[model samples]
Target chain A: MTMNKLQKSERFSVVKKILIIITSLFAGFATGVFGGGGGMIIVPILTGLYGLQQTKAHATAIATIFPLCLVSVIFYLTHGGWEWKSGLVVTAGVVVGGIVGALAMKKIPAKWLQPIFYILMIVGGIKMLAQ
Target chain B: MQYLWYIIAGLIGGVIGGMGMGGGTLLIPILTIFLGVEQVEAQLTNLISFLPMAIVAVIIHAKNKRIDFKAMLWVSVPALVTACVGAYFAPRVKSEWLSKGFGAFLTLLGVAMIIKIIVQKIKSKRRANK
Candidate 1:
């Protein structure tokens, strides 16, 4: 990339930054409120508005959600809503599944992934709402 | 066969989690709605399960240079703070209301995405014509 183009791309607009932070905050809030789904929101903002590549956006969204998840977990533990045994079992699945999924990211094209994500979100949202 | 479900659930959730889409969204519903786990327990399980997956995915992404650490830092601070606040306020809301609202939000996003696709197609078609 040319220096001018690189600089232009890297330059963070104040408006954009604020928008990102605000969205991030809301995503975090959603995670806390729903105890999940923050990444759903974060990934979109990163990919759509922040202009991150799809793969990077997916990875970054996970990274961004880490701290928020930790915070909420603390509350879940203290506030008396956890089932450790079941959580342990699920954790085992996620650990293995997560690694595989991350590797799988390389195989999928961005065009396909975005729609898959949207479909998952729509399906998940509907299921939760119906329940 | 009974414990198989947990492993299967974890594996699926882990894969999705690694994809950065939040496995809990998938895992929780599967556990609660299908597997007969209680809602709160399912939610908590999702949270715990994501921890290790997140760590693994992030580390891999980091090595691949896929993560923008600067943006991660910028988003994390407020997210961390608000997450706590959201958790604090969560108990006040009725579970039914919460589910309904979350459901509505997801549907809205889905609709928005379809609109986005249409808009982009129109813009490209215009460009092509010129």
Candidate 2:
């Protein structure tokens, strides 16, 4: 889609706002308790529940992460569990990776991406268990 | 049916995030594979949702004095700037390649984490043996 088309769709209706808010809250809570996974719920909620198109939903998701990361970083810092040097390094990596990943998102096809994503999840889950 | 999945996703995500792992590692895949969300949508959604939670967590951590503001400044400044750049460019990339790339990255990271844990455990054991 062209930039104009994407821009036009960016504006949210009342219902969309409500849905986004509700979804964002749920996502927030999940992130707090799980350490990550808000986006898993956010995307589906946006697409399935809120009716946003795929790319737009993704863009919106990135917009939302800023607040969440800020909150978590603060909490970690205050709690004394965070390693500043490590967090800085990781965050730096995430930023760079995130940009690259985002740019890549616009070029990749959904079909190939979805299955591979699923496989990674299953493997990750199993790995978590092993850990 | 869908709501059920959302609930499940929320629960799983919460647990994972609470533990300090990346929920995106799991969430993106579930959305794309089972829920039929596109890769871009799923990833963005994960990033977006992370915003509030990270903020809250940071607040709590900050109050408890866990935050490293000096370090955070370095990390967050770049993170914020890059995130915007990422968001702006994401949609132009094709979906499949992004998915594959993300998936591969996650897999490698997971494996590396596991390996690190094992190595740590062995090193500890050897230390104890001595």
- Weakest 10 consecutive residues, lDDT, candidate 1 chain A? A108-117
Q: Which ranges in model 1 have alpha carbons more than 4 Å from their true place? A: A1-12, A108-117, B113-130
Residue-by-residue lDDT tens digits, candidate 1, B3-122 = 688889888777766665556777766776567776556666887777776777678779999998877887788888899988776655666776677677666766677677778889
CAPRI quality of model 2: incorrect
Q: Estimate each model's TM-score.
A: 0.80, 0.51
| Native-to-model Cα distance after best TM-score fit, residue A81 in candidate 2, in Å | 36
lDDT of 2 by residue, B1-130 (tens): 5555654554444344433344557765665666676655555445444554555554555565544343223223333443333444344456765566555555654565455446767999999999
lDDT for residue A44 in candidate 1, whole number 0-100: 79
* TM-score of decoy 1: 0.80
State the weakest 10-residue window (summed lDDT) of model 2 chain B: B70-79
Candidate 1 residue lDDT tens string, A16-124: 7888889988888888877788887888788876779877887888889888888887887777756677678778878878778868877864455656766776887
Candidates 1 onward: DockQ, in order: 0.62, 0.05
Highest TM-score against the true fold, candidate: 1
